[model samples]
Target: MSELTVRSMTEIEFGQWYSSLVRAYADEQVAAGNWSAENALQMARQSNETLLPDGFATAGMLFLKGELHDGTAIGVLWIGLTHPRGIADCAFLYDIEVESAHRGAGYGRKLLAAGEDVVRRHGVSALELNVFGDNDRARRLYQSSGYRVITQQMRKTLTDER
Candidate 1:
């Protein structure tokens, strides 16, 4: 495996990161039946606007890019510092994505480990992330990395009856 490095994203990389994030979110929304493909893009835009009004500049947010030692971009991560009502301050991973071409090369694991290091350096002792139930690959990665489920949500569709 090649060396993986995570660095704060530069302005030049923001556009790519934002675009990818939006597309990923939209895809998830469609898969979850929250939005139709025809409107997913628009809904994604509006949701992002509401959630990240300041974009990557939002307070407590950290945007990072992952690359190989040879300078090949492999992934992007978005983390946010959070203080839940009963727990110490911790880091929440909002998004983590390894490019499709780079998948299965261990880049995802490396990138996540690097993210842990980055958050730990900031004095945070815990990290949290949410993975959709259908993303088995990602769920496996997170599980192997020592993340256990703290909570889960399930949904089902029922036939309409008049």
Candidate 2:
């Protein structure tokens, strides 16, 4: 496990991070069968239209980059302040990604732990995140990190010929 550092994203870093986020979102959407590849790309572009340039500056949102001990960028984490179930204030992890090449090196786990420390400094006691059903790796990571399933959402595809 390398020493992890989480820092506020600079403007120059935002462009690369945003691109990765959009790509991830589209891929997840496609995996979930919510949209075709083409449609997912279009929808992802549209969905992020307002989020760039300055959206993360909104009330209680944070965009951070994770770096290794040598200052190599390893990942990004986006968190938003939210109150779930009237719990007052909690941190919601909107997105987290470890660069493809850095996967399986324990970077993701370190990045998440660093993220929790960042959120905790903001006085948030709880952290919540949503992971797609098909994302087994992420599910396992979150579970190992002490996150529990508070709810489960299931979907069914009905056939017209039936």
Question: How do the predictions measure up, each by TM-score?
Answer: 0.90, 0.88
Local distance difference test scores for all models: 0.88, 0.85
Clashes of 2: 0
Best by TM-score: 1
Q: Residue 149 of model 2: what lDDT?
A: 98
Candidate 2 lDDT tens digits, 1-162: 778899999877877777878888998889899889878987998877654435555667788999987998899998876653445767788889998989999999999999999999999899998899988999999999999998899999899986
User: Which ranges in model 2 have alpha carbons more than 4 Å from their true place?
Assistant: 49-53, 83-87
Top lDDT: which candidate number? Answer: 1
Clashing pairs in model 2, backbone N/Cα/C closer than 3 A: none
In candidate 1, which residue pairs clash? Answer: none
